[model samples]
Target: MRVSQSMKPENAAKKLGILLEAAPESFREGTVTRDELAALQADPPEWLATLRREGPHPKRVVAEKLGISNSGLARSGITDPLTTAEIKALLAAPPEWLVTERATQAAVRAEKVRVAERDKERAARGASDARRSGGGGV
Candidate 1:
């Protein structure tokens, strides 16, 4: 388990199989070590716990957090995780792109729900129609 003292935080996070953007500031502040990296994988610290809770998350997590899809993230050019501070800041003063994406996400969710309900109604109608038309000579 060899580790360089001057290893970049991002590289260290990569070595640890974690996204640096998802890591807490404390984790980024400290120099990464093989032992520490292994320890984090085996047993995480407070910073690690925080990172797990409030993430610079994976693409899936990011999408869910933002209520948007990966395609939205791509369209918005959001390749990195937004920190809690960053998230708050954006919420306080959302950019046009963020606003637009949120609207799109809302519309998408609404459409999906509407489609599901419609499908359910159609299925129910079909079942009732089958029962009504199920006439056979005794």
Candidate 2:
């Protein structure tokens, strides 16, 4: 994407891989030059340095990393960005909430898989019935 001054703060933050909350107030307010954006991506400022250690992780990213849901993050009081270490610790020693959230995630994934398989089977059955009926297009 062509980085331009017209880009919004959120877009700039996404491009730089820093969270909007992690970026400085000035950065959040002003438009960024392409060069500035590139520089930020290449070498984030001191404030963003901590984001490097942890992240500008959004809710989805954080949840996926922690194997939890957005609500789970809230229940765990993880309202802020978490470092890789914190995520690792949670994984290494699963808490009740973490265990529960992981199960939920797993169940959601399994259901999606099952639904996809069922859809595929239905499609195949439809195709077979169409072939048997000899109605394979006029």
Best prediction by TM-score: 2
Give one digit per residue, the lDDT tens place, for model 2 in 1-138: 964556788887777656788667898896877778778778777877777567757665678788777887888777877666777887999889888878887898899999999999999999899999998577
Best by lDDT: 2
Q: Show where candidate 1 strays beyond 4 Å.
A: 1-45, 135-138
- All candidates' TM-scores? 0.61, 0.70
Ten-residue stretch with the least lDDT total in model 1: 55-64
* Tens digits of lDDT, candidate 1, 46-74: 77767656666565556666666778878
Backbone clashes for every candidate come to 1, 0
Q: Where is model 2 more than 4 Å wrong at Cα?
A: 1-5, 14-17, 24-26, 32-53, 136-138
Give all candidates' CA lDDT scores: 0.73, 0.78
